[model samples]
Target: MSGPVSSTPAALTAPPKSPKVAPAPPAPAAPTLRDSNNNNNNNNNNNNNVVIDGILSKLLGARQTADGSCARVQLTNRELLEVTRRAQQVFSEESMLLRVSPPLRVFGDLHGQFRDFLLLLDQTGLPPGTRFLFLGDYVDRGEQSLEVVTLLFALKVRFPTSVFLLRGNHEVQPVNRRYGFFQEVTSRYNLEIYARFGSAFAYMPVAAVVGEKIFCVHGGISPRLHNLDQIRDIPRPARVPKQGLLTDLLWADPHPAAENFTDNLERGGGVPGAFRFRPHMSRPPALYKRPRIFCRSTTTHYLLGA
Candidate 1:
């Protein structure tokens, strides 16, 4: 306590002087993979080195025409058979009604127009990055029926989660035989190939849903399709079913004129199963078409296309 007591080593009693620490500098931004010459070369090499033996890979590597239309003959009979078998096997595993997510590119009635299909692929990106739900008629009435169907089957096999194929009227033997695909396959390959394709079609889904909003069908809706599960519960791997939800989905067309039509009698068209629905339709038609429907308490709905 005497002689100022050396101020009691002032630091010990006074608030301890905080260590003079310099604030940390801002951390550098995480490194990003900017495409560079070195990286591009590596990526190219990796892509080249990958060994794929499936039909999809064959289609990917197959030479397009000068106009980038139809694919040339890339598969042998053996390869085509194997691919068709794979298609039947894979499609069989899918539900009668598919449930795909948003971010899809849906198309209607390719009709064996391999060139247009190729053009579409060129315009829009293919999947798993960009998924697709083709609404049938994959074969018939085009120069490249085999090419189109084979490529589709290959795609479905290659990216099962990313590609979905629905059934159209032309998918059945009765239609395709009279149209073009049946004769085309028979003339080009054989009846065996044609038959195999029919098998694949039998397993195809009649419709698909996108999110909880959209319903995708090739033709139109059925009265029985009032509930979603009705579509889901229809047993698949059977021939285009005779006069039911399945038949209506494949054969019917939209009677857009009528909101809630109940066509009990045919007007001379007399097509036994040909029916229509006031409310019908798909997931994606690209970014071009989006359906905005307004529902009222009266059960009538209005679709405002934007």
Candidate 2:
């Protein structure tokens, strides 16, 4: 079913220009702990300092004011470090807490439903010390794609380590253009950030292995993918082609059959292979009585019964 895709002019408006904010004061050097000789501690202390400096660089690099009226502060390095440290502490403490309660409230197809998305947060509770994996499809087909993306981006900034976002079929450019995400991004953030976020989406993981058992993805299984390792070996480009290795995986459908199959139907037919499919069972009574015969061909098995 189609639904309204919200677009707010304000969400796309450029930030107002204001006076440059002063940079924060430098941090005090970490104190060195050394033995009586005090010879080796200097190197260790320097290494630690270098690591801290690297983190500070990332924080400072990401800092930039959007405009004058915007009170929202992009994270600074100091803030990022603090957030990371806090997240680490929380993880250490609550590593086992979620196991006893729930499997982390998995969600699917949040196509930029910003309002409902927030409601979901209120309903499911934020991913403070726990885990939540969104099965992709975060953008497109909704008005609040910008808000949705920015909100998730902000969450990534805040929680960093705890929040997980995977790439869905809609994440690809062509599909996104046909869907609503491309328009939502261009309308809201202009093409620049849209491109940036698109690039970000490319790097996003395609699937997630949850709790070591269930495999979650936006789409289904493909004949090309016989096992999970094959999928992992596939080189994911920064963006997917219209149809190819990545596209097939993100768009393929799974079947219920025990083995792969082939039929008179073309290569891309709905029931191309012997894989399990829920739709095949919905045929006419006659077909059910003389159901398709199962045969193993050179390349794949076939379901045959005219």
Question: Who wins the lDDT comparison?
Answer: 1
Residue 208 of model 1: what lDDT? 73
Question: Top TM-score: which candidate number?
Answer: 1
Q: What are the Cα lDDT values of the candidates?
A: 0.61, 0.45
Residue-level lDDT of model 1, residues 1-306, one tens digit each, is 001123222111122223322321111121111121223335543342222134444553444444545446546787777777767877888888777776777677778776567556644545554567888888878877887888788667656777788888788888888878878887878888888888888888887766655656776656555566676677766666556767777776545665553552452223476564464333113312432432211123335344
Residue 259, model 1: lDDT of 52
Among residues 3 or more apart in sequence or in different chains, the pairs in candidate 1 whose N, CA or C atoms overlap within 3 Å are: none
lDDT for model 1 comes to: 0.61
Q: Let me know the TM-score candidate 1 reaches against the reference structure.
A: 0.69
> How many pairs of residues collide in model 2?
13
Off by over 4 Å in 1: 1-54, 61-71, 256-259, 262-270, 279-306
